[model samples]
Target: MKKLLKNIKLVLFFAGLVLVVFLANCGLTPLTIEVPSVVNANEVATFILNCGTEPRIANTDPPYTSKLIVGFMVPKSWKAAQNTTVELISSEKGNSTLVLIPSAEKEAASGLAWPDAAKKRFGIGPNLLDDFEWLVYRSVPAYTFINNEDIKFKVKISSKVGSENSFSRLGFFILSAKENLRPEDTDYTKYAFSNNFSVTNGEGDLVDYVNPQLAKVEPVKSLDNDFISLNFDAGIIETTLSNTDEIFLEARGFTKSGQQIAITTKVDKTRLKPLGGKKYRIDIWPRGLLNVPQNETLDRFEYYFTNAAGNAKVGYGNTADPFRYTFKCP
Candidate 1:
């Protein structure tokens, strides 16, 4: 009985040791995340993140100084720096404004800039589209967290929507400069992604980044200087071009002054690149595709998809009228 008791004690001791190591290794812990699912562009959307750092077992005997960084994976149209505000609240230091940092500033621990460091640590955070951008911010007056003290940081984000109706799984990443999240240490760098968020009461077609769509445009917001992609997903919806194996683009561009330039988009020059599962896409440069002169700027486009050898054609909502896109850089 004595020997059996000794064995049991040893097993329990090892289990407790493992548990302690796990807790000691924990770095940044996000306690609660409150995010909105859908919001109006005309209104302000708010979200909160309650986070803490584990009281270190030993090296924490000395106070550590570091700035906390938060990155937002948001729609480019939001102009997050101009429209979003980040506030950091700490019981020890009161509330302070978290200001946006230029993406080019390099982190001491990592050779890359904060944005590039974050991208290397976490890429896009499960967002499907490439139109999103990362807006990085740092808490003001680099804070020194005391040793063996229980401190919590509350981050509040208020975002104002831009003039586009769209959906995206917004991403947030939090980390401290003290723990720049090298490859071996994974605890401090934490990523939190919101649900399929939406912004309505804006302009143009619904630029959906969350789910599959029948037709869509890339870069949600772009000017003629930016190259844009037109996508067609025939499998998601039963359109006139559903069974058409070969698809071609037919489009017309209009200038700001209403001068029309018809693009010769129906030939092999305008063929869409086929992606499996009945989807296709074609990238176009506005001025080049329309053969526009340097003096005139293209403003919008009307486009359609048609079968290579048949009369089957598809337009907006699979109708006869062409699908329209109004170009606005904002």
Candidate 2:
């Protein structure tokens, strides 16, 4: 009976030790986010990352804090520049995963593969990020418990920035909890928090370049119809700079068979005529130019702008704003 009592006490002591270790392994860290209002294709947005007021033991041993990687998505029509730049704002102490993708078409050709889970989480596909490519830059290791309020570093964008038209510049503040951090434990109670920022110099209307008004597409009855039509208000950002050359428009169609038809040619910019202060519309149709088959599930459409110099930009285009009530024809 006495031996049984000793065994019970030992078991209880070990259990308590395990609990203490678990508590020590897991903690919390706060992360605040402040994204820029706008980022130009070729311009860089400077940012600051400061760890706020929080006092806790940072994981110093094998299991360190989480690692963060940043990313962005460019629009399809953007032409890749010769030299793209990405400058870090904070301490350039750690390694990052910065890469440049030429076009969504290059993904399949790049021979890159990922688990289904990561693919779905990041919305990886040919078109979702089709027209654009990617750029990645890796940073070195950094372990600074920034608990004070101060501005960080100034990261620069690529010199080969895509033209504002073709590139839909995006910023991603990515975090990976699995790196060096405790896997079995879920809570991060002892970490600090930070709010990121990007600097912007000016503001302009979406109409400055194209018509600020909405764009329309004349819907067709059959998917196999060889012709497609679209209409939209023009956008012109600069009034004084009237090199008013030719404007080009392009059409893309996503079919039910998981196929997309992109335009070999662009629309005309001169078609834009002012309706009011910043309102105008243009009608577009690829009659003999485009050969689109009649398919029942004609999903979406997009319109972009380009000048005679071949400079391009993407305006607004939609799938829900139907120009015609689609019906089957016997």
Candidate 3:
């Protein structure tokens, strides 16, 4: 009787161990997220996610079928830029998938293999198998809320497992612009000057003269922040007054509450050159330049030009109509 009882207990123990291993292999493991404890609303933010074990990639036909999804939640009053979708591919030998190209096309083009294509796409070194882990970088543009209060941002990650789904939360982190000390005077008034002064030649006529004209105004969508690029016609300014006169682009950003933010003289070094004959483009990054009020949306941007000579023109000609760029601010 004692020997029979011991045998029964041994059998039960083995069964329980097998059951635990099966459950672990079939179950989903939560991913660990690493992010900054505090983030600046005026700068780009990044997050990294780590998985302990190889995530199961459903053997789907399409390579681009999203295996992992990430989302961000901000305050109702605050706005966030568009979300980026990252598709995770299997890195296992022979099981590696190339989602960049369709399977049909892939099979048709027989000369190059899928592994070669993946190597090129991922910029993997020669010893690809040695590097088992893959890292993806995602950036979110900076944004500020209305009030000085701290704001929490939530990040969520989900993965599809067979017919069900596994989810993980990254929790929340505080984002604020005021937490970090900023320049007190963010207005561009100091850079604002008169546009009445001009230069003349020995003939006392407008010779070799150039008046700044608004050529093109467009929004630059980027991971840093939504910025405005202003192109100006510097006609002969490059050769004529390139050394003496300083050209400045002025822009006024208005909030829904009627508060005004401006970018006057601050110019990026890269955009401080003449594109061609009298063509200059100035890109305005609003992070530190445009002081947006918390919660209020920037509805429109009014742009003009000024120079050391104070004779810069606003539009194409003297009688040109008023121009402004409108956007759905977030």
Candidate 4:
């Protein structure tokens, strides 16, 4: 019985030693993240990150601490607002510092690229913005120990108004001891985490960015056989236009036999002035300006208009209710 007890004791001792070694070898703790449930487009938002383990510089000639790099992935339809900036604040100290996140490719290229080990571990390739899909990363010197520290950061994001819809998912990443770390390092994965948060509208009204509305179209009297006058009620132009900007009118004529002909005419800014109230008018001469054959037009007309930005008003056709008019040769 005594010998058996000794053998059991030796086995227990060896197992405890092994467990201690394993714990000591494990360098980093898993990272934790928190983000807001909803964020507005073209607004600044806050995200929180907690670094589990203290970051340290492995080897330095002068014994200086390395850098902590934070990365963000902005979707293709989103853009970093002009003068977009980030502020990192330490939760414990309430101390904050300004960090610049570069939107330009020329500036971004100057940063360190992820090493092969990091790329393989995270399953990500070279980070680059494709078609306005931006990946912004910024690094700050790890001057203070950030073990289990909650770091709060503010980010400003703007939507490519017309390209983005009601929602977009943004990705985030963190790398500790970035200056001394390589992508291929065995510990790279341990000190990093990648996750995503979504930005969505709370009320769910996705406003149209550049849609122009055509309110009314009136066929003013045909001026002789050479020209036709049309009064266009182009409802409130929401977008501000420069002096050089132009609006175009598209007119389609259908004959009694159903043969269709179309022509486009440019309406200068001078003709698009306000008519008394909120309504605006544009006098168009589609026949003479577009060279539409006057002899072939026997029946109906369709009208559509567009601004210089390609924002078009809904097309009007012969089947339109209440105000539909059929052209008759007089």
Q: Judged by lDDT, which candidate is best?
A: 1
lDDT of 4 by residue, 179-254 (tens): 3334444432233322333344432333222232234433321332333333333334442222222445555656
Q: C-alpha displacement of 152 in model 4, angstroms? A: 12
Off by over 4 Å in 3: 1-213, 220-224, 235-245, 263-272, 316-322
Candidate 1 Cα outliers beyond 4 Å, as residue runs: 1-16, 23-25, 108-110, 142-148, 183-185, 263-265, 293-295, 317-321
How close is every model to the real structure, measured as TM-score? 0.82, 0.34, 0.30, 0.38
Root-mean-square deviation of Cα positions for candidate 2 versus the true structure, in angstroms: 15.4
As a TM-score, model 3 comes out at: 0.30
lDDT of 3 by residue, 209-270 (tens): 12333454443212214765666665633333344335565667777778887765535532
Instruction: Estimate, for each residue in 177-211, the C-alpha lDDT of model 1 and write its tens digit.
Output: 67765766657777788888888888777777877
lDDT of 2 by residue, 31-100 (tens): 3334454556456444333222221334445524333333333332233333544445445343242444
Cα error, residue 19 of model 4, in Å, equals 11
After superposition on all CA atoms, what RMSD does each candidate show versus the true structure?
Answer: 3.6, 15.4, 25.0, 17.8
Query: Where does model 4 exceed 4 Å of error?
Result: 1-28, 55-64, 81-83, 91-98, 101-134, 139-163, 166-168, 177-181, 186-198, 201-330
Higher-ranked by lDDT: 1 or 2: 1
Q: Highest TM-score: give the candidate number.
A: 1
Poorest 10 consecutive residues by lDDT, candidate 4 = 124-133
Q: What is the number of residue pairs that collide in model 3?
A: 7
Give the Å error, residue 46, model 1.
2.0
